[model samples]
Target: MNDVYVVGVGMTPFGKHPDRSAADLAAEAILGALDDAGLRTVDIEAAWVGHVYQGMAMGQRGLGAAGISGLPITNVENACSSGSTAIYEAATALKAGAYDIVLALGVELLSTKFRGALAPDESDIEAQIGLTMPSVYAMRARRHMEQYGTTPRMLAAIASKNKFNASLNPLAQFKKPVTVDEVMAGRLIAEPLHLHECAPVSDGAAAVILVSGKKLSQLGSSRAIRLVASALRSGKLEVGLPDMTVEDLTWRTAEAAYQQAGLGPDDVQMAEVHDCFSIAEATRIEGLKLYPLGEYPARVERGEAGLGGRLPVNMSGGLLGKGHPLGATGVAQVIEIVKQLRGEAKDRQVPGAKVGLAHCRGGKARGVEGTACTVNILTI
Candidate 1:
């Protein structure tokens, strides 16, 4: 087995891209990564592309637009974890000596796909009952409040923090920071959840070029970031009414990743967890054990999770401020971690970041805790 390293990372601005085709966005990201890696298309041994609503042959179409073809290209779709799952597949192949150099890309043209709040598949019972993502998270928020004494203001504070971080990010969708009061005053989406707390619909793409240890030695690039672990897990069926305030799936996935990386939550210097909603961030970090259960809200309020604090989370502005383009999200998270590790994140950079984790959880099904979850650990 070969050790895998990411040589380059790239992401398009995450926001409305109604004028761009999915292939175009993917190609831009792919080329940007190639340029960053100082490599050419011919250097890629194979490619994997993750997307949800881009239909069939997305891998072929995206790579074709990037002037890459005649190689094995696998298309992946695992809901919101689609992009991260693509990275997981690529890493597995590299570790198994299947490829010396591979490209993993995630793209979505969500602006032209849907409008308003997103829901589960219509066939799902929850979707049929008109339960949306906002409503589901709202219920979790309410429960956390009841159980942990969290407040609506605390959730707004989370939003304010991410948006402020986004202001420092050039590619973030929402550049201007909003106050906690602004977040609180925003139109209510569901009970206890305002529009500002929800991740907006976005269209974007991101890409990373990974190489084996031998290939890295051949390239002699000093910018390579080692990928220590890439772990994925699917949610299990609920036996009974489970605790909504906790995320068993996230904990299990992070445990697997930490084990594979030979590290623990204490070693993680920074993180980019799935923040589809304000409440999601609080629950995810808790599940990852980055913060104690029922203590993240207070920690966040104390500036512990912000940049230059104890442990910065979502320095890329997260989905709340960075925009959630479904397929692109997971890959984008990895890109942020890569940048922070490389000391290239400028204003939002976490000081002396070494070990960073990226988490992505997606989808919902009837009677299941979650659909798909992925955690990737990287180190400089």
Candidate 2:
């Protein structure tokens, strides 16, 4: 099998775009990535698109808008992990020698899709019980507090750090730095989680160009970021009473990714984790083994996870401040890491960074910890 590298990455500014169609957003992202790769429409061998609520032939519509057609375009919808899953499929094809150059695009125009809080599919018993995304995280926050003495202020600090990081990212949804006090005083979505602590409903798109080792050699581009590992796993069924604060699914997926990359969490210099909620950041870092269990909250308080700290997490403001555009989120996380590894993340750059990790967990279903979880390791 051959290695795969991300030769190009592009994304639209994440925010409410009531007038933009999903196809428009996707087409823009695709063109940007093609330009970034220094490639043209005719260079792509195949394509895969990740989307939900975009209706049938979403990939075809988006790619057609970009003037790309007649190529195999697989559509993926693994909830929020859809984007990363598309990347995984593209890499898989490259490794299998099915195609040398592939495009993985993720797009979602969520502003026009739904209003108010997002919930699990109605088929899910949990959704029937009034379980919303925020409420689920709120319950997890409560569990973390009970297990580790975490305070609401500590949770707010996570939001503050991410939002501050967002201020440096021109494309982020919320570019202004928010204060912990402001976060704490924000409207309550669920107990222990304020509106500021939750990821906003966003509309955006991101795309990446994946190439085989042979393709990379032919291109001879120094801008490529090696995709050292890509691991995806579904949440296991909960049995008996288990610790809700711990993320077994994330650990399993991350472990697989580390082994595949031949690098552990300690080797990662920066990370873009799934911080759909303030507390999710802490739990994800701990689960990824980037920090000791029950210690990330204090680590944030001491700025250990800040831009210039020991390990920078969510330098793109993450989902909390960067905005979570569902299908687009996972791909956007990889884009941020690629930028950071390439020394192009100007204001939020983690200096001397060599390795980065991107984690994305999405969706909620009945009797599962999560719907899908993905871990991708990238290196310069």
Candidate 3:
């Protein structure tokens, strides 16, 4: 297999834009990525797109708008991790030497229909039983509290910290800094989660270009960050795992990625994690084994996730600040990490960041794409 490297990355702000469709937003991201790569439309060889609930043929529609068509543009729907899954596909194809230049795009334009879209509507019993995303996450939060003594305040602190980070981001949906008290007082969306703790309905897209190390000459002597590892796994049953904590899928995938990279969490200088919600970030920090299990929430409360803190997480403000554009979020994270590696993030940059890690997962605590997840490590 060949080595893969990210050549360019780009993103659109994550938020509500009732006027925009998923296709147009995605095209803008593609253009931005292409421009960043200093390439033209014909430079891309293949592409993969990730999205969900955007209606049929959405991938083709979005790609066509980007001025690339008929190049094996496959659409992936892996729930919230949709964007990350797409990135893994692009990197895998490049690593396998099937393509030198592959583009991955993640886009979503959410409407009210997105709320109930997860139900088993004309599909399964879960949907018929009214199993919505919020409730599923709420259950996880509740369980975490029961088993680990996690609390609403801890969850709120996560939200508040992310919101504060979001304030540094110009594109985020909610830019104002929030406090734990405010999050606690916020409207309750489900059992233990206040509405503020929930990821709001957002629409946006992100794009990235992956090139084989052999193709680095195309960029003409610019310092290159190589893709050290990319691993993806779907969730499976694993008893005894506490709620919202590390899952077997991400753990296993990270193990493979770490093996491939010949590095561990300690090698990662910074991370662009999947913070679908505040608590999600806290749990993922443990799930990814970035820290000991159950310690991430407390660290965040101590201002450990800030820009210059121990691990400087979600520097692009993450999904919380960057806005969760569903399918596009994973790629956006990649974009931010690339900037970190290149020292181009300016104000939002992680200082002297050398090795970076990015992870994405979709859907529930378990099941299919919901359980599906990917972890990638990159370095210059």
> How far off is residue 182 in model 3, in Å?
1.3
Encode model 1's per-residue lDDT on 110-204: one tens digit a residue.
88879998998999988998989888899999999999999999998899999999999999999999999999999999989999999999999
> How many residue pairs clash per model?
0, 0, 8
Highest-scoring model, lDDT: 1
Where model 1 places Cα greater than 4 Å from the true spot, the runs are: none
- What local lDDT score does residue 365 receive in model 2, on the 0 to 100 scale? 90
The positional error of residue 157 in candidate 1, measured at the CA in angstroms, is 0.7
Candidate 1, clashing residue pairs? none
Could you give the candidate ranking by lDDT, starting with the highest?
1, 2, 3
What does candidate 2's lDDT look like per residue over 119-220, in tens digits? 999888888989999999999999999999999999999999999999999999997999999999999999999999999999999999999999999999
